[model samples]
Target: MQFIINGETVEVAADIRTSLLDLLRNYLGFTGTKKGCDQGACGACTVLVDGERINSCLALAVQYQHRNITTVEGLARNGSLHPLQQAFIDHDGFQCGYCTPGQLCSAIGMASEIERNIPSVVTKDLSATSVMLDETEFRERMSGNLCRCGAYNGIVEAISEATVPAAAAKTAGRASP
Candidate 1:
């Protein structure tokens, strides 16, 4: 089967029942997306499927044929770290780093959702035309990804710094100048 991963098209022969995570890590050698739990309960296997985040453990390889698959390795561009990645470093968003890959991907996808004004569970005004990236929204949107090192504060701060505008972040005290 053919898969488009990290802006490259590659073909691999695999079993029909292979999970996307298995296909990525085992077959294609994209080991950045870790396998913390085989089940989707843990967000360690998150990846961007056509710019949207999905739990790769629960997805089948065949189901993503011809679609854009972006792993943590693909987040950088022109040899520069992605903004969120840099933010992660600046804010110490990770410790053991096992969940950093998934957190990065999920945060980027969540930023896109916010750009489109998509409402989350804590969205008080669905008709407000714009969703604020406040604490409630951040917590609710990022609840799925877990960090065993107890780095939730840094993760939230990093995401807020990267996704929220500088002025807004300053107003909310989410990021440094």
Candidate 2:
């Protein structure tokens, strides 16, 4: 299968059903994405697929063919950390750091989703002209991601402090996971 990992293009020969998470950690040697709750209940295996967050544990390696996959390690640029990563660090977003990777990737995607006006279950008054970041919207979108470290407060703060678009931030929220 051929896929773009981080910013590199590569090809691999593996079982079609192998999870992208396993291929990344075992075969590709990129272990940033964690394998918590292999059933996909936990967002530990989260990765950005074509700029959207997907639970790698639930996705097959073959399914990623020709798509861009961004793991926790991919968010950095030329040795510089992504803004979200820096924000997480600045806000002390993690204790154990096991779930930090997924949280970061999910935040980027969620922020984009909200910026694009994608409504979530908690979007009260969806008919409202703009999506606003509030406790309710933040919690609903981030419900899938979990943090055993009890760093929810800092995580939320980090995302809230990120440089999301002003229009997006008006409606999209940074919720605790």
On lDDT, the candidate that comes out on top is 1
Per-candidate clashes come to 0, 7
lDDT of 1 by residue, 38-93 (tens): 89877999999998999999999999999999999999999999999999999999
Per-residue lDDT tens digits for candidate 2, residues 1-177, read 898999899888899989999999988999999999998887998999998899999999998899989999999998899888999999999999999999999988898787677788877777876666677877777878999979999888787777454326464443333
For residue 86, model 1's alpha carbon misses the true position, in angstroms, by 1.2
What does candidate 1 score on TM?
Answer: 0.91
lDDT of each prediction vs. the true structure? 0.87, 0.85
Stretches of candidate 2 above 4 Å error? 163-177
Worst 10 residues of 2 by lDDT: 167-176
Global Cα RMSD, each model: 3.0, 2.5
Off by over 4 Å in 1: 166-177
